[model samples]
Target: QPRHSKRQPEWHQRDQDELVVNQPESATLDESQKPAYADQDSGSNKRKTRGIQQENAKDTVVLSKEISEDSKLAADKAMEAMGANILTELKEVQTNLKKQITDQSGLITKEMSEFRKEMGKRLDDIVADLKDVKNRVEEAEQRITEVEEFNMDVKDVLSHTLQLQEDLQTRLTDLEARSRRNNIRIHGVTKGEEGDNLQKFIENFIKTELSLTDTTLGIQRCHRPLGPKPPSGSNPRSIVIHFLEYTMKELVLRSAWGKKVIQLKEKRVFFDQDFPSDILAKRKAYNPIRKILKEKGLRFQTMYPSRLRVFYQNGPVIYNSAQDVSDDMRKRNMFEAAGKPTEDASQPKPGAFSWEGASGIQRWTRETRVKHIQEKLRAFKHNDNTL
Candidate 1:
């Protein structure tokens, strides 16, 4: 039912007819010269021409087969050549890639080595620094330990020194008090009352004023304390009397105390035992307590070297320091009657014995002792260094 072109078959038939008509003259005679057997000859000639055409067709088929085989061989050879070229190019590319990979690997390995070395060096430096710091810290700790030990030794030395100083001071005070034992101080006498003969004047004055019948009063020496003469209207300096006999001195002092109120030239006079300036300061600190005792009608006696003996209704109590007496008065609830302690009683004079310890020795305050120790230590260390 579909229409197809028939021009190919027509062209093939026409080509076959032309091939028969174009045959050579040797193969076919002219029609005019043919015998009466032309029909048979023509049949035979057609058979021969057909045979030749068959052989030519066979040869053409063989030639076409050979050409197809040759063309396949050529095409196979060309494909093989092209494959070889592509293989060579692939090998070159592979070689280049391998070289690049090798180069990159080497570079990477070299860089890694450098990085490792640098890190190792930095780590070493850090380790060294840590070691240095540790050593310094250890040294500082050692120094601190030494310093603490030195401070302890210094404290021990200072404590011993303070004890020795206290002992020295006690001995000195005792010596001074002993020196002043037999001396008596007379006050309220006008200046220059003894005139030229000091001993004669004192002997006559004591017998007359003190009512001493003993005319043979043994006297060693007598004089005013070394100082400038007092101006007019001022209280005269006391007369210090040194007697040869201690008993006679005691007798004279007792007589003066018994008199209570002695007058000379219309002026009231007083007598007291001569004491060192330091002991006097310590004794004077008791004035406030003495006044309180007097006001309260309590009898008390002052002992040698700054001591107080209170005669209470219950019993007699002795105190070594004014602070102790004040404390006792406070305990007895008698301090309020006198108000607060006077400055002299509360604050002691410098270089004055304020309080006595259980050992009967006086001590400086803790702060004062430490400060002195530090100064001494500094001086000692400086001396040692200089040596």
Candidate 2:
């Protein structure tokens, strides 16, 4: 229960100094320095000395115990003070470390918040751009649909217009052909052979060449076709003869058909019905088919305005175009029957009527030509009588 001191305890230092002084005193005292009773108290002095030694040892033990107790108390107090200082320092360090951690956590949270906001803004921008692209794609699809519809309409209109044009062309060709029904074309006559009076010259030439002196020919007009005249030795321009009456024209044609060959001024001539150039072109399209039919020995007749009447074993089939004829021939397995053509097949036949003059008629026997002419004449006479 002693009070604590900063320096060493004063009681401990005083005890040490007393022990030193007493040690020197006990060591300096001698036997000669003992008093007059020394001899009489020698035994007593010896006993006293023993008692003093025992007392000193007891004192020393007591002093040592006291010093040791003081030292243990001081050490315990010093250790307690050092422990209190260390605890205070540790508390301060922990508080500072906690504050630093809180500050760092706040800074990190702020940065994370900013990053999240930026990422959200970028996402919104991307979504808006995607919406715009979707709208544009829809608009493009709508425009494409409109274009497709417009294209379909244009195609329909174009198809209708083409059909209408084809019909108009057909009607025009029919009218042109009908207008030239009573006209006759005379080919292979020399240039200027008809002289100034072309109508009279035609009438005279027909009557003499066809032996039609008894028949009356009602020739309304006669003239060459409107074109530049041919050079010498080339083919002469045709003479178009327009008859006043269709029946008289038919009669003349029938008579001309009866003759194998007709000559005018010692040159061979040809007679045929005149048709429009369009009709002529359509008939010319049948030339390849006609050659094929001729090679196969098939009987086929070219009707007016480019119609073909093919005589088949089953029945007679009529075709308006060479393509139809070809298809039918293929179906009947007769297309290959024509086979390869000879070198001379492409060449024109001698004394044969030209395609422009005779509507591309094939060569026929004299009897067949006569028979067809008779039938046509009878039909003409019946129609005339009916009118």
Candidate 3:
């Protein structure tokens, strides 16, 4: 409820009036004109400031472009100056490198030439030395070959000489065997013709012993003769024994009067010497034993005591003969035994059969005349079952 009266305070009123300032109409118009003037002045000042800024901007742009151009020009000039200096230094270094290469090439060429000359001299000397060595070796090899050939020749000669000697020895052996023509030999490991020879000796010994008729043994109580013939048939008979090689034979002979035992070979021997009974150079044997037996009164002519005469030798006993071998006529007096004349031949004195005849037999048994005949047949025809 506010009243519009004049009783209000003067300040309130004054505030209102001042806020709504009530002046004369002309004065109000005049104040409004003053603001227009101030606005024009501000507008003018702003335009002037804007114009100055545009001019400063244009000037700064022009100066920046000019400085950029100047800096480019300076850089181009510096590049040109550095290029000339670098070219000059490069030329100087190229000249120095060429001189050094030339100097090194010359030194290497000179060294190569010297080395070639030295090597050529050394190679020539080596080649000459090798040639001399090869020549000497060839000469030595030739000498060695000659020596080898000579040694082979000497060996061949010695071999030929040895073969000749062997041939000669073989020939000598053949000649010795040929000289004895059908002549009987009495020898062997223990007996030879001596085998049959010893047989005859035994018979002769028996005949002498039994002919005494003084022994208590009966005439038929002994062994018989191994001869091919009978003891008696009213005729003289011969006993043949052919032993061309080894004769390991034995004979048992006898008669009604006595017994004859003959051992042809008991040991082996040569034609010129006695028999050997062992594998020794020499040894005591039966001959010595026989000698001792004779000393003890045992009668064995082959022993040293019996002293057999060749005239009565029934075996080819190696004994002294009763006749004189020097006198040819007296030596062959066989006819004188039967009261007949003696005959002679124009043969040499040593070529007589003085070594043969009489009853050349040895007996080991005494059998009847008929029995003796049967035994010979038995020996010849009888088959030995033991074989």
Q: Candidate 1, overall lDDT?
A: 0.79
* lDDT of candidates 1 onward, in order: 0.79, 0.75, 0.42
- In TM-score terms, which candidate is top? 1
List the candidates ranked by TM-score, beginning with the highest: 1, 2, 3
Residues 1-387 of candidate 2: C-alpha lDDT, one tens digit per residue: 354333444665685576567543433558778666655566765686687668667766776677779979988999999999999999999999999999999999999999999999999999999999999999999999999788767655655665575578679879989899999898888876767888888888888888889878888888888854455778888989999889888888887877858886688888888988766756777888889888878799999878999897788989987667777777777766575323322122345432232344556434334334544555554554475
Candidate 2, after superposition: displacement of residue 308 in Å?
Answer: 1.9
Give me the runs in candidate 2 sitting further than 4 Å from their true place. 1-128, 155-163, 195-197, 214-216, 226-237, 264-267, 313-315, 332-337, 340-387
Better of 2 and 3 by TM-score: 2
- Give the least accurate 10-residue stretch of model 1, judged by summed lDDT: 1-10
Candidate 1 residue lDDT tens string, 3-86: 222223354567678767876554477787667777776688689779867866776676666667777787899999999999
TM of each candidate vs. truth = 0.55, 0.52, 0.33
In angstroms, give how far residue 16 of model 1 lies from its true place.
47
> lDDT score, residue 337, model 1?
65
